[model samples]
Target: MENLSLGLMLMAVGMITVFSILLIVIYLSKLLIAIVNKVAPEEVAVKKATATASAPTVIDPNTMAAITGAVNIVTGGKGKVMKVEKI
Candidate 1:
């Protein structure tokens, strides 16, 4: 009976010790992150100037016809090419 009680006590102690160490590690890591962030803050990203819209692209008749034909074939004459844009 004494041996069983000692075993239970040892198990409880080990579990408590491990739990305390894990909690300490987690809190310490959080503190370190906070300190580092305060010391060297992240830089704000610069916004890029957007490209202006140019003149409408002109599609040649042959290329337009080919695109139209492909669309018609894929959609069984139900689809229409409304606008074509170059990459």
Candidate 2:
């Protein structure tokens, strides 16, 4: 019947449209990843240069001790503990 043929044609068109959209999305993601990778090295170099241009600063011993103490408390001093205890 003519109606059956029209239905088949519409189904084919819908499938084709879905496939086309999927391929477009995949292609765009690949393009964006490539662009980011290409530009990343230059961006990193700029950041490093800006960081190096800043004057070096000294840390206070008290602040360092407090930070280390907090980390040790959180970790339960596991890092300093001898695990094997080799005799």
Candidate 3:
């Protein structure tokens, strides 16, 4: 009876140790990712909404065709994309 109890105790301790190590590794990885994101924040170009509203949009012939085809397929050939513009 004592031997069986000792074996179960050791098994529980081993599992707890493994779980603790996994948690520590996960914490360290998250900390590293946070530090990296802070150091290298993404660059977003913000334009004036009023300026965007008045700009002349131009569509490439190739892109327009591809977009039309994709849209037609996605809409089950029921509709099409009339235009695609590069801003």
Candidate 4:
């Protein structure tokens, strides 16, 4: 009976120690995240609300003709360029 009681006491103590350490780790991690976020905050890119972003760019008539001709030649006049996007 004494041996069984001693075994139970040791198991309880070991489990409590592990549980306490895990709780401490959780709180410390939360604290570290808060400190890091507050110190070096992320930079958000704030773009100006411009009419240019939504508008389509005008291409010179000759340049458009050349691009259209080249694309038609490459695809054997099968694929047509519906819209040209400039980066």
Candidate 5:
């Protein structure tokens, strides 16, 4: 029937239109991201040296004991605390 053929044609046209629009939007978004990155690139973070960088940090007796106890409990007494340092 002519009506059936017309309906199919309309559906095909709508699908093609939506697909083309979606493709255009995707390409445009990629272009915008590339343009923005080129205009203002991300900066590399610089780490500043601490004043006590050369000196060794001393851990409190209580804090050290607590950390050691926690590690032992978590690892079922199989883990050993070789070094404890302050970040």
Candidate 6:
């Protein structure tokens, strides 16, 4: 019927329009992300905070005592830490 053909044509036009718009949006979003990454990129935090690998780490007596005390309490005085390292 003519009415059925007309309805099918309208539906095809609407679906094609929606798909075209969605494709444009996807490409635009990808382009924006690429622009942002090129202009101002995300920096790694680990590179900004680093210590000399050659120097030994030192802890103050008070900090060491507190850490040992906490460990002792947590372990019910059954374990002790031989060494400590800063990560």
lDDT for each of the candidates?
0.81, 0.73, 0.77, 0.80, 0.83, 0.83
Candidate 6, residue 26: Cα displacement in angstroms equals 0.8
TM-score of each: 0.45, 0.44, 0.43, 0.44, 0.45, 0.45
- Model 2's alpha-carbon lDDT is 0.73
What is the TM-score of candidate 4? 0.44
Best candidate, lDDT: 6
Q: Write down the worst ten-residue block by lDDT for model 5.
A: 42-51
Q: Candidate 3 on 1-87: residue-level lDDT in tens? A: 999999999999999999999999999999988887788654322345435653776555686788888888899999966555555
| Candidate with more favorable, higher TM-score: 1 or 2 | 1
lDDT of 5 by residue, 2-39 (tens): 99999999999999999999999999999998887788
Task: Please write out the lDDT profile of model 1 over residues 1-87, one tens digit for every residue.
Answer: 999999999999999999999999999999998987788654421211122222356676899999999999999999989999878
Residue-pair clashes per prediction, in order, are: 0, 0, 0, 0, 0, 0
Candidates 3 and 5, the one with greater lDDT = 5
Give candidate 6's whole-model lDDT. Answer: 0.83
Better of 1 and 3 by TM-score: 1
Tens-place lDDT digits, model 2, residues 1-81: 999999999999999999999999999999988998797658788777756653353344585677677778989976442
- Between candidates 4 and 6, which one is better according to lDDT? 6
lDDT of 1 at 62: 100
- TM-score: which is higher, 3 or 5? 5
lDDT of 4 at 21: 99
Look at candidate 2 and give me any clashing residue pairs.
none
| After superposition, candidate 5 runs with Cα above 4 Å error | 42-87
C-alpha lDDT of residue 21 in model 5? 100
| lDDT value, residue 11 of candidate 3 | 100
Give model 1's clash tally. Answer: 0
Off by over 4 Å in 1: 42-87
Error of model 5, residue 70, in angstroms: 33
Off by over 4 Å in 6: 43-87
